[model samples]
Target: MSFTDELSTVADPLWDAIEGHPMVERLGAGTLSTDPFEYWVRQDYVYLVDYARVFAYGAGTAPDVARMGTFAELLDSTINTEMDLHRAYAAEFGISEAELEATEASPTTRAYTDFLVRTAATGSFGDLVAVLLPCMWGFNETAERLRERGKPDDERYAEWIDTYAGAEFTELTTWCKELMDDVARDASDAERERYRDLFYESGRYEYRFWDAAWRQEGWEL
Candidate 1:
C-alpha cells in the first residue's frame, strides 16, 4: 500500500482524537483567530533555525555514510522549502530576520525541536520518522482543513493558512508519510507503537501551542 494508505490505516485513531478536540473546532471555526498566529509564526521561524542545525547533525552522523548523502539532500531540501519559506512568512508579518534569530523559542518549541534532533542523531531511521511524521502530517492536515474552511478569505489569516496549505508543504508531508510507510512495512510492533505515540504526542503539543498562543497577553492585535 502507499504511504497515504498506510497513514490512514495506522494513524487514523490518533487523528480522530485530535480532530475531536474542542480546540480544533475553535481553531477551524475561526473562533480562536488572533494576533498570536503572527506571533507564533515568528516564534516558529526561530525554532526552525535550531531544526535546521539538528537536521545538519543528522546529515553528518548517519551510520550508513551514504545515508549521510540522503540526509544532506533531505536537510537541504527541508531548509530551502520549510525554513526559507518561514523566513518569507516572517517578512510578510513585518518581522525581521534579526528579530527572529535573536528571539528565544518557547519551552514547547524547544522541547519539540530538541526531540527531533535527538531522534535524528541517535535513533534508527524508523525512530526519526516516528518523531517527524506527526509534525508534517498534522500541520498539513490542519492547514488544509483551515484553508478549505475559508480561512484564506480573511485578510488577517490568509497568509498563515496559505503557507502550510501550499503544494510544497503538502508534498513534504506526503514524502514523509511515504518514508514512514516504507519503514512500517517491516517494523516491529514496538516500533509501530512508537510512531503512533509520537503522532499523538505531537498533535497534542500542536493544540497546546495554539491554545497558549491564543491566550497569551496582547494576543488581540
Candidate 2:
C-alpha cells in the first residue's frame, strides 16, 4: 500500500469525522450560516499566509529543480490564486481587504499553523511533507466527497464547495500524493512511522480547525 493508504488505516476515523463534520454537511446542503463561513474564510486566509511559507520552505529544501518548481508554483498560487478566492469571499461578506489582512488567528488556527511552520522551518523534506500532506489531501478529499452528493443551489456555499472538489484541486491532491509516495518509497521504517504519526496529527488538527469555526472558538482572555 502507498504510505497515504497505510496512514489512512490509522487515520480513517478522523478523516471520516472531518468529512462528516456538521460544518461540512451544512455547506454541502447549502443550509450553512454565513457567519460561520465568514469566520472560516477569515481564519483560513491567515492560515494560508503561513501556508505559503511552508511551500517556500519545501522549494528551498527540495533536492531537484522539478520538485522545487512544483513547490514554487504552489507558493505562487497560494499568495496569488488561492488568496484571490478568499478576497472574493471576504467581499461577499462586506469584509474589506484591510480587515482580512488584519484578521486574527483563533487558538486552533494558531496552533495548527504554528505546527506547520515549525515543521517546515526545522524538519527534513520528508518531515515537512509528512505534516503538509494531510491539508493538501484532506481538503480535496472532503470537497470531492461532498461534491459527490451533488451540487447545491445555494450561492453562499456553492463556490466554497466547488473550489475544493473542482478539477484543479483534485489534480493538486493527486500531485501531493505522488510527492509523499516518492519519499515513502525509500523511507526507513522508523521514518515511515514518524510520517504516519505526523499525518495523523495533522488530520486531527484539520478536524479541529473546522470544529473551531463551527463553534466560533476563540482564546478567552
Candidate 3:
C-alpha cells in the first residue's frame, strides 16, 4: 500500500469518529445550530492564520525547489484565497472582519495549530507533510462523504461541502498524498513509524477541533 493508504488504515477509526461527530453530521444535514457554527468559524479563522505559517515553514524546509514552490503557493492560497472565503462566511453570520481579526483561539484550536507550527519549524520536511496531510485529506473525505449523501438544504453548508469536495481541493489533497508517499519511499522504518505517529496525533487533534466547536469549549480560569 502507498504510505498515505497505510496512514488511512491506521487513522480509519479516528476519521470515522470525526465524520460521525454531531457537528459534522448536522452540518451535512443542514440542521446544525448557528451558535456552534459561529464558534467554529471564529476558531478556525485563527487556526488558519497559524496554518499558513506552517506552510511557510514547509517552504523554508523543503529539500527541492519544486516542493518549496508548492508550499509557497499553498501559503499564498491559504492567506489570500481561503481566508477571504472564511471572512465572507463569517460575514454571513454577522461576524465583522474586525471581529474575526480579534477572535481568540480556543484551547483546541491553539493546541492543534501550535502542534502543527512546532512540528513544521523543528521537524524534517517529511514530518511536516505527515502532520499536514490530515487536515486537507480529512476535510476532502468528509466533504465527499457529505456530498454522497446529497447536498444539504442549507446553502452555506452546501457551499462548504462543495468547497472541500470540489476539484481544486481534491487536486491539492492528491498532491499531498503523493508527496507523503514520495517522502516515505526514502525513509527508514523508524522514520516511517514516527511519521505514522505524527499523522495519527494530527488526526486526533482534528477530531478534537470538531468536538470543541460542538461543545463550544472554553478554558476555565
Candidate 4:
C-alpha cells in the first residue's frame, strides 16, 4: 500500500468518529444552529491566519522546487483567496471583517494552530506534510460524503459542501497525499513512525475542532 493509504487505514477509526460527530452531521443536514457555526467561523478565521503560516513554513521547508512552489501557491491562496471568501461568508451571517480580525482563538483553536505551526517549524518537511494531511483530507472527505447525501437545503451550508467537494479542493487534497507518500518513501522507519504519530495526533485535533464548535467551547476560567 502507498504510505498515505496505510496512514488512512490506521486512522480510519478517527475518520469515522469525525464523520459521525454531531457538528458535522448537523451541518450536513442543514439543521445546525447559527450560533455554533458562527462561533466556528470566528475561531476558524483566527485559525486560518496561522494555517497560512504553516503553509509558509512548508514553502521554506519543502525538499524540491516543485513542492516549494506548490506550498507557496497554497500560502498565497489561503491568505488572499480563501480568507477573502471566508470574510464574505462571515458577512452573510452579520459578522464584520473587524469582528473576524478581532476573534480570540478559543483554547482548542489556539492549541490546534500551535501544534500545527510548531510541527511545521521544528520538524522535517515530511513531518509537516503528515500533520497537514488531516485537515485538507478530512474536510474534502467530509464534504464529499455530505454531498453524496445530496446538498443541504440551507444555501450557506450547501455552498460550504460545494466548496470543499469541488474539483479544485479535491485536486489539492490529492497533491498533498502524493507529497506525503513521496516523503514517506524516503523516510527511515523511525521517521515514518514519528510521521504516523503526528498524523494521528492531528486527526484527533480535527475531531476536537468540530466538537469545540459544536459546544462553542471556551475557556472556563
- Model 4 has how many clashing residue pairs? 0
Local distance difference test, each candidate: 0.66, 0.89, 0.92, 0.91
lDDT of 2 by residue, 19-53 (tens): 78999899988888888999999999999999999
User: Which 10 successive residues of model 4 have the least lDDT summed?
Assistant: 7-16
The better-scoring model by lDDT among 1 and 3 is 3
RMSD of each: 4.3, 1.0, 0.8, 0.9
Candidate 4 per-residue lDDT over residues 1-221, each given as its tens digit: 89988887767788788879999999999998999988888888899999999999999988789889999999999888778868988998888999898998899999999999999999988899999999899889989989998888998789889888999999999999999999999999999999999999998999999999999998888
Model 1 CA deviation exceeding 4 Å by range: 1-34, 57-70, 217-221
Candidate 1 TM-score, C-alpha based: 0.75
Query: If scored against the real structure, what TM-score would every candidate get?
Result: 0.75, 0.97, 0.98, 0.97
lDDT of 1 by residue, 120-193 (tens): 77877777766667766877787777777676445535655676778877887877777677778788878777
Pairs that clash in candidate 2:
none
- For model 3, how does the per-residue alpha-carbon lDDT over 1-221 read when each residue is reduced to its tens digit? 89888887877888789889999999999999989998988998999999999999999999999999999999999989888878988988888988997987888998999999999988999999999999998899999999999999998899889899999999999999999999999999999999999999998999999999999999896
lDDT of 1 at 116: 73
Q: Model 4 compared with the native: what TM-score?
A: 0.97
In Å, residue 84's CA in model 1 sits off its true spot by 3.8
lDDT preference between candidates 3 and 4, better one: 3
